[model samples]
Structure formats: structure tokens, C-alpha cells
Target: MPLNIDWRQILLHLFNFCILAIALYFLLYKPVKNFMAKRSARYEEEAAESAKLKAEAEELKKQYSDKLTNADAEIEAKRSEALHELHDYREKLVSEAEQEAGEIVEKAKKDASRERKKIIDGAGKEIADMVGAAAEKVVLGSTADAYDAFLNAAEKSIEKEENEIK
Candidate 1:
């Protein structure tokens, strides 16, 4: 076996390694690096756009919240106003009904009093007519002797009724 390496073989292998490295840099390394750079840039742009969209969404949410709050307050105020109006209307209706009832009671009382007065007047007139009729009969009967006793009895009844009237 030869102890010393051949110089030509060593030089030839080194030359082949250099040529392969250069070819790989041009064919694979440069394109792969460019593709990686473009992909990274696209990712960065997407991230920036996503962040902007998120901020816009947050602003819209705040605006909607404010509108909702205002709407709730407005609805509450309107409800309160409606309730107050309803209460007032109910009170007014109750008051009017009470007033009408009072009027009806007063009218009924007046009518009862008038009716009672008419009944009392009619009773007095009836009593006077009955007494007058009894007195006339007694006076006519007094001409006969047997009727004289009946006249005295009738006179006594008249005195009793007069006392009762007093």
C-alpha cells in the first residue's frame, strides 16, 4: 500500500465540492430564502390588518353599548311617564265616580224626604175627612131618642181622636 495520498485526487474532490455548493445556492437556496421572506411578510401584513379590524370592532361595540344604554334610559323614562299618566287618569275617574255617587245619595235623600212629607200630608187630610164624616152622621142621628145615645157615644170618640191629634 502507498503511504502518500495522490495530489490530483484531492484537488479534484475539492473542486467538485465548490461547484456543487455554488449550483445549490443559485438553484435551491436563493429561491427558498425568497419564498420564506415573502411568506413572513404576508403573515406580518395579515397580523396588522387583523389588529386594525379588532380595534374597529371594539369601537363599534362601545358605540352600540352607548346606544343601548341611552335607549334603555329612554324606555324607562317613557314607561314612568305612562305609569304616571295612568295613575292620574285612574284617580280622576275614581274621583268622578265618587262625586257621582255622592250626588245620587243626596238626590235619593231629598226624594225620600219629599215622599215622606207627601205621605204625612195625605194621612192628615184623610184623618180630617174621616172626622168630618163621623161628626155629620152623629149630628143627623141625634134627632131620635135611640140615636141620642149613639150621638153621645160618637161625641166621646171624636174627643178621643182630637186628644190623640194634639
Candidate 2:
């Protein structure tokens, strides 16, 4: 009954406080700590997956770069081969054209020689005919002595021309 002392009531309050602390530890603290731990583990897993994906992407980029470099080298080699082929073809064509031109020039010279021979033959035949006709006119209605002389001169001239032709 004193104003400053009550041992029984203090013991009762202490027992109630202990019971509340036990209930709170099981109901709130344990579950909250478990949730926080699970969240942290999930974050770590996600970070590892992101790093793995980044590494794979870098490997793919290197492969593509190597392929591009090889392709460029192949293209350059093909271009060089084409240029060489073109040069060889041009040389062959030029040689063929030169040979054809030489053949044409030779043929032209042969044709000109043949034409000259033909013209000379035609002129010789015409001259012979003119000489024969003139002789005939000179001997027309002549005396026997004059006709004999004309015939002898004509024979000698024709023999001389034949010897010269030979």
C-alpha cells in the first residue's frame, strides 16, 4: 500500500513484456529479414546473367569483324585477277589485229601486181593488131613487086617484136 513500491505488479508487467517480444520476433523480424535476404540474392543472380550476356555479345562482334576483313581481302584478290586477265586479252587482240593488217597489205600488193601484168598484156595485143591492119592496108591493090617488099618488111618487124617479148 505504499506510494513508491509494488513488487507484484512490476513482476506481472515484466512477464507481459517478455511474451510480447517473443511474439514480435517470430511474426515480424524473422519474416522481414528473410524477405530482404531473398531480394538481395535475386539482384545478384540478375547481375550475373547481364554480365554473361554482355560477354557473348562482345564475342559475336569480334567474329563479325574477322569475317568482314576476310571478305575485303577476297574482293581485292578477285579484282587483281580480273585486271590481269583484261591486260592479257588486250594484248592478244592487238596482236591479232596487227597480223590481220599485215595479211591485208600483202594481198593488196599481189593484186596490184596481177593487174599491172594484165594491162601490159592487153596493150601488147592491141599493138600487134594495129600493126597487122596497117600492113594489110599498105598492100591493098599493090603491084606484085611492091607487095613482096611489104610482106618481107612486115615479117621481119614481127619477128623482132617476138624476140623482144621473149
Candidate 3:
């Protein structure tokens, strides 16, 4: 009252401000704080779950990569093995062909040799018959000498035929 100050009005206004503060704390501040806490907890849980999923994905990726590499190596090994087998088979076929060729050549040589011997024997017999006929016509008086001469001539003819054929 001394300086126109109304102490009663001041006290009443202060009391009203206290009531408003308390009401706001309970109605707005507490609810907002609890909502924020729940939201933060949910966000943290989602982050943990996301991290776990990411880690599992990374593990699966690494495993798949390893398997892919191993598969490539396995495929290469199989291809190499197949190629080696093919090469071996080729060699075996070549060897068999060579052996067959050698056998064919040997058979041909044997056939030719037998044919040559047959021809030589036939020629020798023909020459002997011809010489015997000539001797009989030329020397009717000296039979022994004629026979010896025919034998010598036939032997010489056979030797000459063999040498020429060779």
C-alpha cells in the first residue's frame, strides 16, 4: 500500500500460476515424455532387429560366395578329368590302329612270299619238262649223258630264275 503494491492480488496470481503448472505437468508433459520413451524403445528394438538381419545376410552372402568358388573349381576339375580321359582314349585308339596296320602288313607280306614260292616251284617244274623233252629229241644214242646234261641245265635255270626274281 505504500508504493501502490497490492500484495493480495500478487499472491492470488502466484497461486493460479502454480495450479496451471501442476495441471500442465500431469496432463501434457507426463504423457508426452512417456510417449517419447516408448517410441525410443521401439526404435531401438527395430534397430537391433535390423542389425541382426543384416549380419545374417552377410553370413549367407559369404557362404554363397565360397560355394560358388568351390563349384567353379569342381567344374574345372571335372573338365580336366574328362579331357584327360579323352586324350587317353585317343591314344588307345591310335595304338590299336597301329597294331592293326602292322598285322595287315605282316599278313600281306606272308601272302606275297607264299605266292612267290609257288610261282618259283611251278616255273622250275615247267623248265625241267621242257629240258627233258629237248634232251630226248637230241641225244637218242647217249642216254646217260643226255640225262646228266638235262639235269644240269634245269638246275642252272632254276638258280637263274630265283636270282632274277629276288
Q: Evaluated with lDDT, which candidate comes out highest?
A: 3
Q: After superposition, how far is residue 152 of candidate 3 from its true place, in Å?
A: 20
At residue 2, what lDDT does model 3 achieve? 89
- 1-166 per-residue lDDT for model 3 (tens digits): 7888898989999999999999999999999999999999999999999999999999999999999999999999999999999999999999999999999999999988997898778887877686767677576657666677777777777787778668
lDDT of 3: 0.88
lDDT head-to-head 1 vs 3, winner: 3
| Residue 102 lDDT in candidate 1 | 100
lDDT of 1: 0.82
* C-alpha TM-score for every candidate: 0.58, 0.58, 0.75
Model 1 over residues 80-156: C-alpha lDDT tens digits? 99999999999999999999999999999998788768666765775666556556766755435435554665566
Worst 10 residues of 1 by lDDT: 141-150
Give Cα-based local distance difference scores for all models.
0.82, 0.81, 0.88
Stretches off by above 4 angstroms in model 2 are 1-5, 109-166
Top model by TM-score, which number?
3
TM-score of structure candidate 1: 0.58
Candidate 1 collision pairs:
none
Q: Roughly what TM-score does model 2 have, to 2 decimal places? A: 0.58
